[model samples]
Target: MDTEMYIEKDIYVECLNDIGMLEIENDEFFMSPYIRGQRVIHKVLPMHIMQTIFYYTLTLGEFNCNEESVLKTWDSRNEDRFSLEMVCKRWCSIIKASCRSLVLSLNNLEANTFRITHFTYLKKLEIINNVNNDSDYSDYDTSDDEDTKDYSNNDLYYDYFDQRKNITYRRRKRVPNKNSDKLARCLSTTIQLSLPNLSTLNLSMSNLKERHIETIKSALASNKNIKKINLDGCPIGDQGVVFLSEILESNNTIRQLDLQSCGSINGLEYLGRAISNNNTLEKLIWSYNQSNYTSVICLSNGLRNNHSQIKSLILRACDIEGWGALSLSDTLAINKSLRELDLGSNQLGDAGAIALASKINSHPSLSILDLSSNLISTEGIDKILLSIQSNKTLTNLNLSRNQLDLSIPLENLTSSLELNKNLISLNLSECDLQNFHFKQISIALQSNKKLKKLNLSKNNFTIIEPFITIIQSNKNLKSIYISKHKFKSNELFILLNHIFKLNDSIKLDNGEVVNIDIPSIVHQLEYIDLSQSHDPLTKNIILLLREFRKVNNITKIKI
Candidate 1:
C-alpha cells in the first residue's frame, strides 16, 4: 500500500483499538464482536471490510454534512480545530476554510510547520509571544559537553551537586530561543499573500524589532483590509513608529491604532504629523508615556488644526500637567469630533481642572470624562460642577482620589448635581468626603433622578442616614459601591432590612428601637457592594442578604 492509504488504515485501526473493538497480534489484525455485552470474535476480518469501516467512520457526522453547517460548527472552535484538520486532506481543507479568528502562540510555531495561508477566511489574527516559563525548558537537560558550554557572566547554568552520590553535574547554559522571531519572519513573508479578509491584526508583546517592522511595513502597504492594529508592549520604539506613521499618512482605511507602552515617545511627533494629514483614523490609545508633554503639545496642535474624525483619546499616565491639559482643552474647544477623553493618573492640579472645565459646557460631542488622581481640590471641582449646570451631553464623570472637601457650603456643587439631568454615573470614591460632604451629596441625590450608578468607597464617613435616604429616594439608582466603611451591626441591619423589607422593627442590644419601615420605593437597585466593613454584626446581615437575593432575583451583592 502507499503511504497515504497505509496512514489512513493505521489511524482507523488506532481509533477502533481505543474502544477495544480491534486488537493487533504480530502483524495481523483481529476483530472482537460484542455479543450480549461480551467479546466473542475469534477470527480475523478481511482487508476489504476493514477498509470499508475506516472510510465510513471518518466520514460520519459533520464531516460529511453540508459545507455551510460544517463551517458554522468549526468557526466556534477555531483554536481546537487544528487537531481535527490533521485527520485527512479533505478534513484539513474544510477546517482551514472555515476558521475566522485565530490566536497563534509564537512559542509553538515551528519552522515551515504551520502556515498562515491555510486560513483563507481569517478576519482577525493575534500573534503573541508570552514570557518564557519552566514549561519552555522541559526538553532541556544537563549536558557536560564542552563545546556547548558558554562561560558568559550574564548566562545562567545549573550545577547539580549530590552529597550521597558524590558527583557534580553541570548543565549547559540555555541560549535565548529565537523561534518566535523566525516564525514572525516567516509570517511576515506570506502575511500579505493570502489574508484578504483580515481586518484586525494584534501583534502585542511579540518582541517585534527593526527587522520585523521592515517586513510588516511592506505587507501593510498593500493590505487594505486591515483597520485596527495593536502593537502594545512591543519594543519597536522610534523606528517602528516611523513605519506606522508613514502608513497612517497614506492609508485611509485604518481606523484605530493602539501603541500603548511601545516606547515610541520620541516618534509621537511623527504620529502628530500623521494625525494632521490623515482623515479616517477615529480612536488612538497611546498611554503610559512618562513626561511626554512636548509630544502631547504637538498632538494637540495637530488635533486643533485638522478636521479629522478622531473620537476617543486616552492619555492616562502620560504625565500631562496644567499646560498639557490646557493645550488639550484648546484642541477640545475646536475639535468637536472627540467624544471620550481619559486624562487620569497625572499631576493635573486645580489649574488643569479649571482649564478643562472651561470647555465642558460649550463642547458639543464630548461625553465621558475621567479626571481621577489629578490632585484637584474644591476650587477646581467647584468650577467643574458649575460647568455641568449648562452641559447637556456629559453623562459620566470620574473625580476619584482628589482632595474633595465640602465642609464649607458649596451651593453650586449641590445645585449642579440637582439641576443636571443628563449625568448618569458619578464616581467620588477616596475623595476624603466627610459627613458634611455626604449630606450635601444626599441632598443632591434626592432631586437627581437620572443618576443610576454611584461609587463612594474608601472615604472617611460614619453617617449612614444620608445613604439610606439616598437609596430610599433615588429609584433610578441601579448600583452603589460603598466599600471600606465601618458600620455597626444595627446600622447594617437597618440598611439590609430597608432593601429586603424582611423585618418591620428590630430591638438592638442597647435597647434602641430600629425601625425597618423606612418605605424604600426603589426596588430596582441591581447591585450593591458593602465589602471590607469589618463589623462583628456583618455576618448576620450577609446571611439575610443571601436569602433575600435568592428570592428577589437580585443581580449581585458583595458583602
Candidate 2:
C-alpha cells in the first residue's frame, strides 16, 4: 500500500509538471514541496473541500496549518469564511471548529438566524444592531401561525434567552437564566469553554448595562489569567464602574486597563481606589471621557501613595486645565514607575506646560512626552525645550498643533536638543515655521544625527533650500513628513532635485513641481506621496511614475 501511495504521489507530481501547474524542486524538504504544491492544488480544488483537506492534512503532520494559516484564511475585511463554507460542507465544518473570533453585525435578520448555530466555538463575539427601530426583529420569523404568535412580542426575548441557555449549557454545563441571559451567557461561555486561554477582553462599542457589569465581575472572579481589559465607549457608568473596581481590587493579574470614553470622574475615582494598591498594573489609558478637575485631583492624590503601580498615564481631552495639569505633573514627578505621559488636547496653557516641563526635567524615568494641542505658545515651547536640554531620559517629544511661531528662537532650542542626545522623533508640525526657522532646523539636523523621524508639515515654509540641505546632511533620518505646505515653482523644483539626489526616499506633500524627472538613484527610495498635487504637467506624471517604477522597481506609488 505504501509503495502504491508513493507511486500515486509521484504520478500526480509528474502530471502537474507536464501541465506547468506545479513547480517543486527535489532539493527542498518534503514539507516545502507540499506547500508549493498546495498553491496549485487549491486553484483546482473547491475552496471548502480544500480547507477541510488542508486542516486534516495539517493535523496529520502532512501540511502546515498553524495560527498563521488560519489568519491568512480569514483576515479579509470584505469577505468572511462563509463564502468558503458555502463552497462545501467540509469547509463549513472545519471553519466552524477552528474559528476563535466571530464578529456578526446583526444588520440583517436572515443572516443572523442562519449563522447563530455555527458560533459554537466563538471566543470573541461582537453583535452590533444597525437597524433604525426595534421592530426590525420581526423580520426573522417565517414559521407557522402558532409559532409566529409565540414569537411576536416579548416572547421573542424568551426564545432568544432559551437558545442562549441551550448554547451555554451545551458548552459550559450551566443553564443561563433571565438574570444572566443578555451579556452574561456570552461572557460565561467565552470564559468557560471557547476562551479558556483568553487573557485579553476588549468590550468596546457594547451597550453594556449594570447587570452586564455584574456578569463580567462574576466571570473574572475566578479567572486569574486575564491581563488586559479595554471597556472603551461602553455605557458602563458609575455603578458599573464600582463593580469593576471591586473586581480590579480583587484580581491582581490585569496589567493594562483602557477605560477611555466609558465612565465618569466619580467612577474613575472609585476605580482608582480599587486598584490603588495593585503592584502589577502598568498602563492606564483613560482619555476623552469627560473627566473633570476633581477626578484628576483624585487620581493625582491616589498616585501620591506608595502602592500605586501605574507606569504610563494618558489623559488626553479630559477637561484638565492648568491647575489640574500642574497637579498631575507634580504627582508624576514623584512617581517612580511612570515613563510616558500624554496630556494632549487639554486646556494646559503655558503655565501648565512650564510646570510639566519642570517636572519632566526632574523626572528620572519619564522618556516620551506628548503635549500637543495645548495652548502653549513660543515661550512655553522654549521653556519645554530648555527643560528637555537638561532631561537625559526623554527621547520622543510631540509639540504639534500649538501656536509656536517662527519668531521663537530655534537656534537656542536646537542647541539645547543637540546637547541632549537622547531625542529621536520630533514633531513640529503646524507651528507656523518659515524659511528662517527651517534654516535653524537644518543646522540642528546637521548636528543631531540620532534623530530618525521628523514632521514639519502644515507650516508656512515656502523656500525649500534649507530643508533640502537638512535632508542631504541628515543621513540617519528614515522618514520625513512635509505635507500641506505650499511651495514656489522654483522652490518645488529645487526640493525635488535635492530629494532625487538623496539615497533615501522622501515623502512629499501636495504641491506643484514642473517637469520633474525620475532620478537614476531610485532603488533606495521606498515611498512617495504625490496626492492632491495638480500640476500643469499632470499628463506626464504617469510617465514619470512608470520611469520611477522601471528604475527602482517600486512596489507602491501614490499619485
Candidate 3:
C-alpha cells in the first residue's frame, strides 16, 4: 500500500510538471489558488476527473428546484444546454442526443458549420425563412451559374453524413450569393439523412420554388413518421402544387397540411385530386387564395368525393362569392365527415347564406361554422335560424361583422333561439344590434341551458340590463363579450357583482332562506370581456378581477 501511494504521488507530480502547473507564474493555463503571490495546491486533475466534473458539477442538467418551476425554466435550460455543448466534443455528443427541437435560420444557413444530424431525438424542425430575402429565390435572377443547375450528384449541394457519429456535417463551400434553392435542396437532403423522430416540419414563408418543392417531396416521401407539414406563405404555385399532390396521393402518414397563402388557383384541382385520393389527411387550411367560382367548384368536387376524409376546411379571404359558396354548400351537404368550416372574409352575401342555410340543416356532422364578414342581413339570419331550429349537431356559430340590423327585427330567429338546445357559442359582434334586438336576444336566451359563450361586442348598446337578465337566468353561461358599450360604471359593477355572487346560496337554521345570494341564478362564469369600456369601469374591473382571483376559478376578465 505504501509503494502504491508513492507511485501515485509521483505520477501526479509528473502530470503537474507536464501541464506547467509547477511554474512560478502558471496563470497562462491552470487557475491555481494563490495567497500573497505564493501558489497553493498545485495539483493537476486527470482527464477522467475533468470529465466527471464537467458531467456533474459543470453541466446544466435537470433543474429539480421545484416541480412547478421546472416547466418555466425549460426554454432557458434548453438554450444553456446548446451553449454548454460547445465546451467539448464529449458534451456536444451527449447534449445532441437529448435536444428534441431545433430552429435553424435561413439567413445564417451558411454559418451553421456544425452537424445537426447528431440530434437524432429531434421531433420538430422549424426553418426560419425571412420574408425580406424572398427576392433571392425569384425567377428574375437569370444568372446562369453552375450552382443554379440540378445538383442531384453534386457534393457541394449535399451535406455529407457521418455514419459513425450519426451527424450530417455542412460543407465548407460558401455560395457567393444567397441561393435559397441550393440551400433548401441541401436542407432537404439533411432532413432525409437523419432525424428519424422528426414529426413536424415547418417551412412557412420559405419562398419555396418548384425545384425546392420537388426536393422536399422526395426527401419526405418515405418519412412515414412526419404527421404535419406547414408550408404557409410559401409561393409554391401550380407546378409546386402538382408535386405536393403527388406526395399527398402516396403519403398516408400525414394528417394535417397547411398550404395557406401558397399562391395557387388553377392547381387547386390537383390539390382536390390529392385530397380525394389521400385517405389519411384530416385537416386542411387553404386560406387567402384566389378561389373564384370555377376554382372553388373544382375544389368542391374533390371535397364531396367519397374518398375525401377532410374534417376541417378553412377558406378565409378566398374571394369566394355566391357561386363559389353555392359550390361549397353543395359539397358540405354531401361531405358528412366535415365538422368545422371557416368561410369568413369572403364576398358571400345573403344569397350565399341562404344557399348554405338550405344545406346545413340536413348536414349530420358539422358542429362549428364561421360566416362572419359576409353581407348577410336579417333575411339570411332568419332563414338560417329557421333551418337550424331542429338541427341537433351545430354548436358554435359566428355571424359577426354583417348587416343583421334592418328596419324589421328577426323575430323568428329570436324565438328560435329559445328552442334550439345544441347551439353553445353565438358570436354577433358588430352586427348593428340595438336595444330592442338585445332585449329580444336576452328574452330568447332565458331558457337556453346549453349556450355557454356569447359575443355581443361592437354593437354599441346603451342598456346592458338585458344581458344582466341573461346572466341571472342561464346557469351554463361561461364567457360573455359585451365590449364597446355605452354602459355606466355602476351598471357594469352590478353586472360583475351578480356574476361573482352567482350560484352561491345561504339558508337559515330552519331551512328558510334568510338573504338569498343565489346567482340571481346558478352559473360557473369563467370569462368576461368588457374591453373598450369607460376608464373608470376598466379600473373597477381590474380590481374586481384581483378580488375574484383570490377565491374563484374566474380565469380571465379582458378589459
Candidate 4:
C-alpha cells in the first residue's frame, strides 16, 4: 500500500511539473491553503478548476451569480464528468450534478431490471426506441379477469402478429407491454413524478393512441416552459389531435410544432384550428402522406381565417385541386407571415394555377413557391409568368412536369406585366417545347438577369443556337438542364465550346462531340451530366472524366 501510494505521488508530481505548476514564481499565491486543500482531497482536478474557483469567488456578491454559476459550472462539469467518474468518488458527485440531460437510445441500451431511475436535475430527456423491438409494449394484455375478455380480443392480438408478418402494420406500437390507457398512465406518471424540469419532448416512431394523448396532455399541463414538441410520423387520430389542440391553445411558449405524417384530415382540421388561435407558433409543418383531395380542401378552408401566424406550409401529395388552390389563395393573399409554400404532386390545373398566380402577384412576403408535378398547361404557365412579371417578392418558382405547348408566344404572354427583378430560380422541365420555343426563352433570358437555374429538359427543342446565345449573354446563369433533346454533333460542340469559354456548367444527354478540342475546354467545365447518352461519345466521355480527376481547381463533374 505504501509503495503504490509513493508511485501515484511520483506520477502526480511529474504531471504537475510538465504543466509548469511546480516552477511558479508566485508560490505563496499558487500553493495557498485553499489550493493545497483541494489538491489533497480531489483525485482528478481538471485544468479549469482554477478558473471555476476564481469566477465563483469574484462573483459571490452579485445577483447574477446564479446565472453565471450555472453557465460556468455547466462548462466545467461537462469537461470531466464522463471520464472523471472512473477516477474516484468525489468526481462522481460533481459529474452527477452537471450531467442533467439523459439520452437513452433503446436500441443500444442494455436489457436490465425495469425500475425507475431517479434523475434529480434532468431538464432534457430523449428516449428513441425501435417499434419492432421488445421495447414496444403497447399491445401487451395484462387484464386480470381473463374470462371477461371475448374471442375477438384474442383474434385482435393474433391479428397484430399477422399484420407484422405481412408488413402492413400502419401504426407502430412503441410500448407493447402496456395498452393505450396504461401507456398514457405511465407517461403521465413519468412526466409528473420522474422528469419535472423537462422542457422539450420528442416522441417519434410510436403508435400514439387516444389514451396516450391524454397522458401527454396531463404531462404537458404542468410543463409551462415546454417550448418545442415534435411528434413526427406518429399515428395520432382526431381525438389525440384535439388533445394537442387544447394544449397548444393554452401554451404560448411553444414556437414550433411538427405533426408531420400524423393522422387524417379531421386531425389536420384540429391542428389548423389550434394554429389559428395560437399566435406564438412561428412554424407548423404538417406534410400529408396520402393524397386526399377532400381532406386538403377541408384543411385549406380551416386556414381561411386570417389569424394563422404560420410562416412555412408544406402540403406535399395532398391531392389539392383548383378549388383547394383557390381556397389557399384567399388565405395566402391576406396572410402576412407566410413566406414559403410547397404544393408538390397535387392535381392543380389551369384554374388552380391561375388562382395561385393571383396570390403571387399581390402577396408581398411570399418568396418561394413550388407547384411541381401538377396538371398545369400553357395557359396555366402563361398566367403564372404574367404574375411573375408583376410580382417583386417571388424569387424561386418550380413548374416541372406540366405539359405546356411550345407554340405559345412568350413576349405576348409577359408583355403587359413588369418583369420581376427578384426572380432567381425557374424550372420549366417537360414542357414539350420545340426549337422555336428556345428562341422565345432566349429573349426572355436576356430580359431576366436574376435567373440562376433554367431547366428545359424532355422538350422537343432541336436547335441549340439560341440556347448558346442565352448562355453567353446571361452571366448570372449557373446551371442549365437540356436533356432528352436532339442536337447535331457540330451544334453540340459549338454549345460546349461557348459554355467552356463562358465557364458555365451545362447538362446534356449522351452524345459525342467528334473532332472537338478537349484539352482547351476541360479546365473551364465544372459539371456535366451525360448519363443517358450512348455510342462512341461514351468512350471519349470516360477518357475526359479521367483527365479532369487529376485537376484540383475543378469542383464537380457529374456523369
> Best candidate per TM-score, number?
1
Relative to the unseen true structure, what is the C-alpha lDDT of residue 523 in candidate 3, on a scale of 0 to 100? 59
**Candidate 2 segments exceeding 4 Å error:** 1-52, 56-69, 72-181, 192-195, 405-411, 502-546, 553-559
Backbone clash count for every predicted candidate, in the order shown: 0, 0, 2, 9
TM-scores of all models?
Answer: 0.78, 0.69, 0.74, 0.66
Off by over 4 Å in 4: 1-103, 106-126, 131-200, 289-306, 405-418, 457-463, 482-494, 502-531, 534-555
Q: Model 2, residue 555: displacement in angstroms?
A: 11
Ranking by lDDT: 1, 3, 2, 4
Ten residues in a row with the worst lDDT in model 2?
168-177
What is the C-alpha local distance difference test score of each model?
A: 0.73, 0.64, 0.72, 0.61
lDDT by residue (377-453, candidate 4, tens digit) is 88888888888777778888888888875556544333422266887777777777767667877766666667676
* RMSD in Å for model 3: 12.3
Local accuracy of candidate 3 as per-residue lDDT tens digits, 1-559: 1112122324544654676666545554444222211232313445565454444433344433443222211122255554344334454554455556667667444355236666767777777665354553323233447475554545445465899999874443344335666657667766666567878888884667666888778767777788889989888887888998899888988988898888887767788878878888889888987776767877898898888889998889888898888888889878989999999999989899999999988899999999999888988878777877877899999999997757766867576688888999999999888888899888887787788899999996887678777877766888988888877765665566666762243332244442335535555668888787754645555676678778776546776
For each of the candidates, the C-alpha root-mean-square deviation to the true structure, in angstroms, is 8.8, 12.1, 12.3, 10.6
| Candidate 3 C-alpha error for residue 18, in Å | 17
- Across 284-347, the per-residue lDDT of candidate 1 in tens digits comes to 9888866467887888877875657889888788788999899888888989898899999988
TM-score (C-alpha) between model 1 and the true structure: 0.78
Report the candidate with higher TM-score, 1 versus 3.
1
For 1-559, candidate 2 gives per-residue lDDT tens digits of 1212131345656767898887655655464433455556567778766665647543544455456455322222335444444334555566666666555443322234444445455444444433333221234443445432443345343433356556421111222233223444455444544344446666674455556778768767566766777778766777877887787777788888887887566765776676566667788888877777777777887677787788888888887789988888889767887888898998898889888878877788888899999988887888888888778788899999998755556446667657777878888888887777778777777777677767877787667667666655666666676776666544554455455542233333355434433342222224433333424323334444455556655334343
Task: Please say which candidate is ahead in TM-score: 2 or 3.
Answer: 3
